[model samples]
Every structure is written in C-alpha cells, then in structure tokens.
Target chain A: MPDRLLLAGLEIRAGERVLVRDGGFRVDAGEVVALVGASGSGKTLSARAVLGLPGPQPGVVAARCSVEANREVHEPWSGVSEAFATGRLARFRREVEARFRAIRGRIVGYLPQDARGALDPLWTVRRQVEEALALGRTPGRATDWLARSGFRDPASILPLYPHQLSGGMAQRVAIALALARGSRFLLADEPTSGLDPTVQAGILEEIRATSAEGVGILLITHDLRQVHRVAHRVVFMDTGRVVETLDAADMDRARSPEARALLASTARIAWRAFA
Target chain B: MRATLLAGSAVLWLVLLLGLAGPFLPYDVVTAVDPEAIGLAPSLDHWLGTDHLGRDVAWRLLMAPGAFVGPGLLAVAVATTLGVTAGALTGFVGGVLASTIRYLSTVTASIPRFVLVLLVMTIYGSEGWLLGVAAGVAWAPALAEAVHQRIEVLTRAEFVLAARAHGIGSARILLFHLLWVNGRRMVGRQALLLFGYLLVLETTLSYLGGFGVPEPEPSWGNMLAFEFGQHTANPWGLWAPAIAIWVTVLATGIVSEVFAEREHA
Candidate 1:
C-alpha cells in the first residue's frame, strides 16, 4: 500500500560457503533505514545482493531472493538456478542482471563505499552528474543537484575532475551523482567512513535532507552514531544474518549481543570525545 | 623520459614528412633510373649516393617510411579493433562465453605470427596491405589477452562498479569508461608495439623477396635486398634503409615506453 523498497528471504552464497542468510529489510519512502554491523558482518554483502552485484568468487549465487520496489515484486533468484539447472548459467545470469539493470540508477541509486575513488577520473563532476540525470531522464540541472548535495559554488566545482576534488568534495559529488538520478530510493554504503567528523556531519546532513525530500534511503554503515544521526530504523547484522532490529533512538535498548557490543563501542568513543 | 619522448617524436615526424614528400620528389625509382649514375657515391648531385640500378638511394629511402608507416597504422587499427572488442566481451560477459573467447585468443596467439602472415600472403597474393592484415590478425590475440585481463581487474574497480550501480549500459562502460579511460594506456602501448612489430615483419618479408613489396616499390626490405648483392663502393644505399628501420623501430619503442611510464605514474 505504501511506496517502499523491500528485500526479503535473501541468501548469498560464495561457492559452498554462505555469506548472507535470511537477510531482509524494508525502507519506506522518506525514511532512512540503516544496515549496521561490524566489518565482515554481511552488511555490504547484503546491500550488494540487493543490487544483484556479483560476488568476488566464481560460484557466488544469491538464492531465495525476493525484492519489491514501488509495489512491483520480483523473485529474481527464486527458481532461477533450478529452472536452468545446467548448461545455461550465462542465460540465467543475463536474465537476472537485466531485471536488476532495469531498476538500478533509474529507480534505485547507489552511493558505493570509497565514494571518491568511485568517481570516473576522466570526467568532470558536472558531466558525471549530468550523465546520471540524462540516464534517469530526470529534468533538472547538474548545478541543482550539486547544490542539493551541499556544494555552495556548484559552478566552480563543476569543471573539476575527480582527482582535483578533496575527499569531502568528492564525497559530495558522489552524493550529487546518486541524487541526480532522481530515484525513489538510494543505497549509500559507508558514505562518510573516511571523512573527518565535521565533514561526516555535513554528509549525514545531506542524507537527512534527501530523506526529507521523500526519497527512501538504505544507509549501510558500521557506525551506530551515523545511524542515530540520520536513520529512523536500524537493522543490525551479525555474521550473515539480521540479528536485531530496533529504532535508531532505541540503540541503548538493543538486546542482541552483536548490537549491544556495537552500542558499547560507540559509547566508549562518545565518552572519550567528552573526556 | 621527457627527452626521449621528445626526440622520438621528432624523429617519427621527420620520417612522416619525408614519406609524405617521397612521391612528389624528382628522383623516381621506376622511371628516373640513370645509365651513367650507377653506383655513384654520395656527391653534390646525389644525396645518399646511388643504388646499383643507377637510382638515387635517398629517394628510395624516403619511400620506405610511407611503405612501413601506412601498413603499420593499418595493422595497429585492425589489431586494436579486434583485441579491444574480444577483450571487452570476454570481460563483461562471464561464464562459458568468456572462457571460450579467452581460449580462442590464446589459440590465435599461439600460432607463429611470421609463418601465419607468410601463409596468408601466399594465399591472398603478396601485397603490402595484405601483410598488414595478416600481421594484425596474428598480433591481435596478445592485445586481446591484455585487454581481457585488464577488464577483469577493472570491472571490479570502484569506478566501474559505481558506474554499473548508476545503470550505465555495459557496452558504454566497457568502451568509454573501461577501455577509453582506464585501459587507454594499455591499448596505446600494445598498439604501438604491434605497429613496430608489423613494420619489422613487412621489412623482413620484403627482404626475403617473392611475397612482399615487389621490385621498384622501394620498401626498406626490397631496397636492402637490392643493395645487398651490389658491388657499389658506396655503402650508404644499404646503410640508409637499414638505419631508417632501426631508428623508426626504436622511436616506436620509445613512444611505447612513454605510454607504459605514464600508466605507472
């Protein structure tokens, strides 16, 4: 009934080993949902599964996956491997890839980790943003998106390439590129991980602002503080599963050992900041 | 590196200029042979002396650049097109298709290039352009392997993954972003090296006679062939084309080196 992005019953396997099992989350329009966990806790893998990105290994498969966006449902991986069975792996991959391609960037944008390095080095910032706009067929200026991403002098930033941008600036440009697509949903993976505290706050503010504009966002990060800063709901993952789900404000009330440990780590840093 | 690059470029440009001007020069390899000037040493009247056939060696030497460069460019073009296409496809489309493409390239590359070119030329009738085509076909597999390997690595790069996340089509990403942006230096270096190889192959074939730039065409190879058995007191006729091939090939190596250095930088 509501405009939302949902992935449920998802399982990602790399060869014989399962990387993510039974990972599920939902993000309603205008809400910021954070997938939080420690490193190698399947946070990134789960998010990447949602995008249908291939795993690092050759035999990687995302099975039992179900995704619903804007009320249209797709069980892209369900019965996919079984139906093909053998001798048609390429066809199976193509069909699933096409399904995801139809929604990516146009309906669901992504801001990857290492946002600065993710930018095309050969292109200027303006051109990259404009390309996203053109691909999404969204009617807006690159300057408008840049401004929305917190660049005050969008004109000055436009001509600069990725190499010319500082970490904070490149992160902003990456955000602008994701936002320029005018997608109903966005997935940001560790958007402010390497940024200084001040720049981190600025980037989080941009995420909050985008959510306010009625775009549902799934913010993936290990930092619980970032979740509290911008997210409405937090899905805490451990190993390969969603171990806990709690309101961002209720992080202190977390019951799962994994979520509690994360909370304690964040508290130690917060106390250190005060001391 | 900068000095070498500059010097190489200058030499290449001079060769290109002379090659371009060779056709319009007064001394013609076919028609302007003089009965009296046979094997004359380098003098005020003739620069680079005269060949055994009484033709000015300087004019024939000028002709070799166009012969080598024109075919070398064609070879590079063909090789780059085949290599990049095969590589991009192999990288982008994984699974059995990728394996098959890689296998085919390996098989193609395994064949000796010189022998393959010789066979193709023998079948197609020996022409300089045919040499370019055969050499390009033979050399392309190496470039394809390089491109495929590069694409395999680059497809996993943050920039490429980010582009994919943004819903850019695979073809555009492969061509514009992968090959053009990240892989251009690799392509350029390989292409330049292939060009040099093609030049040497052409010269070797032409020198061996029968199936190359035949007769009065004045390719560096055939010129060497003509001057080799001569009893001329002047050795410039032989030295001129040999030195030109050496210098031109060295220049190409220099350019390729520059591309490799820039890539590392």
Candidate 2:
C-alpha cells in the first residue's frame, strides 16, 4: 500500500524552458505506471529524474523525490534536485553513482530507449550479462537468471557480440542484463518502441510477466494503447507538467477534454492502421 | 612459412653479433699495427689492406662495429623510453599539460639534430657516455612527439571510454590497454629511425674529434675523418667503415619497414 517512489512538486528546467513543472507522482510496489504524453511533454525528463539521471544542464525547482520500500524510506534527500542548480552536478553525480552502484543491479534495473547504443560493441552477449551480474554483485546462479530472461541457448547467445544480434535479440539481452542485477524496480523507457508488432507484443508480455514477480515497473512512453494493456495507472504529462493521473482501466470512457483529445488521436491512428 | 627470409634474418643477426663481439674476442692482435704492412693494398697478408697508421683495417673494421653498437644501443634505449612515455602521456591526457609537452617536443625536434648533438657534446665534454646521452637527447623529443600523436587518437575511442566506465584503474587502462596495445608499431618505427640517426650522430661527433679520447682509439667515424685525405690513393680506407655504417642502417630500416607494414595489415 506504500509508494515505492514519489516525486512531489518536481520542476525540471533546461535553460529558460520548464521541461517539467508541478510534476508529482508515485509508483507503488508491484505496480506498472505508464507515463503518456506528446513529444517534449517532459515525460522522459520526469522518468530520468526518478532514476537520478539529469539532463545536460537541468535546474530543478521545489522537488521532494523519495523512494521507499518495505514501509521505510530508501532515499529521502529533500531538495536534492537543487544540486543540479548549484553547479554541484559533478559531486551529485559521484554520490548518485556510489548509491546506484550499491542498489543498481539488485534494487533497480533500467531499460533505456536507445537499446542498441547502450550495449558495448566489443563485448559478446554472455560477457555483458556476466558483467551486469558482476557489477551488481547479484547472488543467484547466472544460468537460472539467463533461462528466466527467455534466452533459449545461453551458450550461443553468450559468445555473439552486439553487432551480430538483431534488434529484438539485443533488447532481450539488455533486459536480461537489467534483471541479472536482481533489481526489483524496472524502469523501461519505451521497451517496444522500435520493434516489429509481433516482437513488441512478445517483449511487452515478458515485461508484464517480470512485473508480476513483485518488481514495480515505470513504463515511460506515449503509446496509450500500451498503457491500456499493461499499466495499472496512467500519468499524463503536458508541457513538462503532470496534467492528469487516473486509473488505466477508466481511461477508455474518460471525459476530460485533454483525455478526449488524446483518445481521439489514438482512435484516428488505430482506424487508419486497420483501414 | 618463409624459411629463406627467416634464415636470412638469422644470418644477419649472427653476423652483427660477431661484429659486435670483435673487441671482446680472445684475439690479442686487435689494432696491432704492422709498420711493414703500412699503405699496403688488399692482400692475403693484410685483408682489406692497412690504414695510413699501418693498423690492420680488417681488425679495425671488425672492432668498429663494437664502438657503434654500445653507444648506439644505449642511445636507442634512452630515446625509445623517453619518447614513448612522453608521447603516450601527452597525447592521452590532453589539455594544457599536453599542449605544454607537445610545444616542448616541437621546439626540440625542430632544432637541427646534428647541431643539438654538437652542443650537448660540447657541454658534457664529449666522453663516450656523454655522446650517448647527447644522441638520446637529440632524438627523444621527436620520437616522443610521434608516440603522443598516436595515443591521443586512441584515447578518444569509444572502446577506451567503455573501459573507463567499467571502473578499471587508470594505470592499467593506460599501460596495458592503451600504451602497450598501440606502442608496438610506434616503438618499432622509432627503433629503426634511431638506428639511422645513431650512425649519423656518431659519425658527426667522431668527425669533429668528439668521439672517445685522443688517437689510438679507432672509431669508424674518426677513421673516415682522418683517412679522407688519402681516400683517392687508397679508396678502401674510406669504404670499409662507410660500408659498415651503411649496412647496419640499411638492415635496421628494412626490419622496421617490415614491422610497420605488418602492423598496418
């Protein structure tokens, strides 16, 4: 019943433009939260803030971001986002890196939007998975972890480098590496954005199954259809602010003007696809 | 696979070793001047003929390789170390520091190497060790600058950045991954370059009366400088030491080229 992560009155600024303002949200344990918005709606910035990855030059105003688990606050550095404004980002980076190292593989997993670019070209798939495990200091057997991640032939997959694998295969390897660290919170930034529909469905389903295992997921994306299928709650962002937050199940019959406008666009796109 | 080429290299190395070992050989007759054989042309008694001083030119030629080999190698070793280390650090760790070192390298390299060697020899009193030091000083900056440029390009590579992200220590990254990996080709090239330069440096210094002590100590360069007056009458006097210097430089150049090409391939 407690929140796993909470961002209160968060404001993220890049130069003079407020990328995200009055952005407050939370993801509860074992919950899937979808962040839906148009491009430049600050959905990505909000998600990045939650993970403590600031933009190139971000200024945060009036933020109280916290991550709690087991009914106790895991991270409670009030006004910590102010570190970005004071030109202390480097120091903040070191602190975040240290904390991230401690919790990254075991407590948090990240699936970045640019899946291919995130992987090392020289390293084989298996070595990367092993590196993730070693980096996180995870305890469970590596073989069991690989099997659960849906890798059919761990032996063959392990030796092939990133360039040799297809987009879907590489994404699967990325997910495997993220999970290999035994992280409980999976931050998936458009996990299926660049994949074929069938492969996308398979990846989304894998994400769903993984989330069911007490791992909370914060899915940052603009696809309302994906939100409908996998998300428990929907947080709508507009012009760098959270315009609305509602139950995902009630989104279909929602009557708010912004919601109606979004739904109309989605329906139009869906109709065109079927035609 | 190439037996003849490998065998040829081996034979060349064997000959070089024998030439180098001439002074230390058990023969007590090195530099034994026979006044009776003075100015004699090439014959069975005095192979390669006798010098103006009546010394056996064959023995002197054999011993000449030892003089060049010792100081030449010492200069190469010093130059290689100084150049590689300076170059690697300057290029890899760029910024104001790199700029400063690079600037210094450029200035030193721009000075005529012979002039620099002469200045160093004059300052240090022209002893054999001083000559070696002068040669190293004259050659190291250029070689270091070359090495620095190579390492700078490699440092910005994505693979290096990935390695850094993995939390590998800087020393290991530089030495094992960056410097060691990229240094083989550069060092090979520098070694060959240094070999040619050493011959020239030694030759220049000995010609100027800066090599070894006074006479009776026969350096190839000193012999050439002294025998130039009699060269037309006795051409072998100049040919013997000149040929030795030429062959050594040529062999090193060939080996270096082969190494450079292999690295490129």
Candidate 3:
C-alpha cells in the first residue's frame, strides 16, 4: 500500500519448459529487499520480467507479469493470458509493454550483473551517464551523478572509456548511470560479485545510502553476507520459485531446508576465512 | 603495406576521376570513330592511340569507368543497406523471424550470384541501373549472413544487454550501439568488398556481351574483349582497361584493410 514496487504471479516459460513459476516479491520505498539464491535459480529472469524483457530464446513467454508502482497496477497479460485470443493477447501485450517502457529507467532502473562488461566500451563515462539522464529527461550534469556514486573527481572520470576504468571504477560508473535516470527503485543484479571485499563494502555502503534516500532496491545476489549487510528483508529462492521471505535480522531463523543449507554454506566459508 | 595502400589509393583516385568525368572530357567517343584513323599508334593527336573503331583509346578508356563505378556504387549502397538491416534486425529479434531469415538466406546463397545476375539481366535487359539492382539483390544474402552472424555473437554481449535493461529502445540500440559502435568495421569492410565484387561482376557481364553494358558504352569488359585480339596493333587499348580494373579492385581491397587496421588500433 505504501509507495512500492510489486511483482506477483509471474511465470516465465520457454516453450513447454518453465523457467520461473509464480515468482513474487515487493520493495517499499526506502527499503532494500535482497533476492538471494544459488546459481541458475532464475533470480535475474524474474526481475527482468517486471520490465517485460523476454529471454534470449524466442517464445520465452512471460505471463501474468504484474508491476505495481506509484499506486498504479500494470499487468502485461491481464487476467488469464490463455483466455484471450492470440490477436487480443498481442494487442494487450503491446499496450502493457508501452507502460512497462515508461516505467523502466524513470521509475525502476536495472543494473546488469557484470558492471564492467555492461558499461558501453565505446562510450565515455560522461556520455553513458548523460544518455541515461537524457532518456529519463532528468535535468542534471554527469558530474553530479558520478559524485553521488562516490567518484571524488568526476570530471577526470568523465572522459575515460570503460576499458580505462578499473573494475570497481566501472561498477561505480554503472551505478551512476543507473541512478542518473532519477529512478525511484533499482534492480541491482550481483552488483558486487566480482569485486574485492574493500570495494564490495564501499558498493554496499553506496547501496545503503541510496536506500536511505528513499529508493526501493531489489538486490539480486548469491551472497548471503551481502543480504545481512544492507537488506531489510531477504527473499530466498530455489530452482525457480521463492522458497522463503524473512527479515534480515531473522535470516538465522529461516526454516526452509534450502535456506538453511545456503546459510550453512556461507557460514562454512566465513569460518574458513577466519580460521 | 603502407606503400601499397598509398599507391593503390592514388591510382584509385585517378581512375575514379576518369570514370566519373569521362563524359565531360574534350573527346567524342561516339562520333569520332574515323575509319581512316583506325589502329593508329599512340601520337600527340590521339593519346593511347586509336582503337579498331578509330576512336581515341584514352577517351574510351576514361568513359569505361562510368560503366562499372556507377553501378558498383549503386550495388554497394543497396546491398549494404538491405543486408545489414535485415541481418541485424532478425538477429536482434530472434526466434521465428531469425529462423525465417536464416532459412531464406541459406536458400538464396546456394545459387551462384553470377547465375542469378545473368538471369536478371536476360529478363530485365542490360541497363546499367538494372544490372546494379540485380547484382545488389544477388549479393545481399551473403552480406546479410555475415551481419547476422556478427550480431548473433554480439547480441549477448554485456553492453548490449545492459543497454536493453536500461530501457533503451531497439532502434537506438541497433543504430548507435550495434551498427555505429560495434558494427562499423564489419559493415565498412562488407561494403568495400561488395563494391569490388560488383565492379568485377559488371565487367565480366559486359565482356560476355549481349546481356551486359551494350555496345558504345565503353565498358572495360567489352573493350578488353574487342581489343585483346588487336593487342599487336595497339597494346594500350588492352592494357588501359585491364590496368584500370586491377587498380580499382586493388585499391578497394587495400582501403578496406587500412580501415580495419585503423579500427583495431
């Protein structure tokens, strides 16, 4: 009911094989909700569905992909998709897709899993951020966005191409571009996956600060430690479905066997590092 | 490599000047076919000597470029635009459309392009524009396949995926990112190769006669075919167009290579 992003009853299918079944989650304003799962758990697919993105394979239908934002509800396939004729469904999809396009970037921005690879190799940092700003019609300079993402000297960073930047720097530039859209919510997918711990902590801190500024974040990651650090709530997924949703403080109390196993694995890794 | 590129480019420029401006040159290839001056060796009155028709070989040689250059440009433009667009679009929006394009391209590609061009010229007549268009259509399938393959490989690249995820529209992605950014080298290379191919094709058809650039048009093909037997009388007629074709094709190839090298560097 609060200003939030909601996705429910989402089903993604490639032909007859189901990828994600009945995936659902919510992130209210100023809250960080981490969607955590092992590799191949369909976390990214479900997140992409809210924006009406089809999978790489054709006929990867995303049905009942419902998005709620700014108190308006948008369903890509209203009611039962199977109930409508092909023509009617196609028309309905077009209508919803337009709305999804409008919501994307402006209302909800997406951060790709690979930060360095995701930044356009040909584009300068300034150009990339400016494009995002231009697309959202957000009035601001690239330097401001870069500064907000933690760059000390944004002008120096502006002229540099993606390859010139270190991995952490590229990630910050990506974050700047994502935030430059004036996005109210962000879908950060594995934002800190390949960074050193110091840089990881810095990025987590940036995410926390962004949340503090009232941006609802749906963080998709495999790191339970990251969930403990910045998330208000955690959604545990296995295979393709959400298995558990629990408060960050109560992750230790999660009862799902998959959740406990994941916790145990993280715990063992942490113990080995300390030992 | 540098010297080859420079020499090729210089020769290319002179050839293009002759081909494009041949009609306006101060010599009459059409009405100057004097029977008295037939097969005259190179002299101050007639540069490069007189051909079997008694027309100045230099004038006819200059006019010859128009036969291939114009049609070659047309073919490259048509083929690159059609081929790149179809290939990139289908590859970007995969599934049924991609499969259909691939299937169609495969079928079209199996038939030799020269054969198809021969059929088109036979049916449509040997007009330059018609030949250009026919050759463009004949060549588009191959260019399309190359572009499609490039797009398929880069379609999943993280930058492309990120652009989509950020809500950038398909047109901008295809135009700016795919074509302009990542695809310029390949497109440029393909366009150059297409133009070279078209030049050769046009020349070959004209040389074959009847179904190519008609008589009095002064194509390198027909000139070579007509004057090669008379090389003993005047060698320049045979050498002029032959050297022109060689220089043009070599220049295009070298230019394409240089462009690719610069892009990589």
Best by DockQ: 1
Candidates sorted by DockQ, best first: 1, 3, 2
Give the TM-score of each candidate: 0.86, 0.62, 0.85
> Could you give candidate 2's per-residue lDDT for residues A150-200 as a string of tens digits?
777766777777777877777777777777766677777787888998888
Q: How many backbone collisions does model 3 have?
A: 0
lDDT by candidate, in order shown = 0.82, 0.70, 0.81
Model 1 segments more than 4 A misplaced: A55-95, A272-275, B1-31, B41-44, B119-125, B228-235, B261-265
Question: Stretches of candidate 3 above 4 Å error?
Answer: A11-22, A55-88, A120-126, A153-165, B1-17, B29-56, B92-107, B154-157, B213-217, B231-235, B259-265
TM-score of 1: 0.86
Encode model 1's per-residue lDDT on A128-184: one tens digit a residue. 988888887888899998998999989999998888898889988988888788677
CAPRI class of candidate 3: medium
lDDT of 2 by residue, B109-165 (tens): 889988887777667677766666677877899888777767776676644543443
Candidate 2: CAPRI quality band:
incorrect
Indicate whether candidate 1 or candidate 2 has the larger DockQ.
1
Give one digit per residue, the lDDT tens place, for model 1 in B144-167.
889888889888889888888888
Using Cα atoms, each model's DockQ against the true complex is: 0.59, 0.12, 0.51
Sorting all predicted structures by TM-score, with the top scorer first, yields: 1, 3, 2
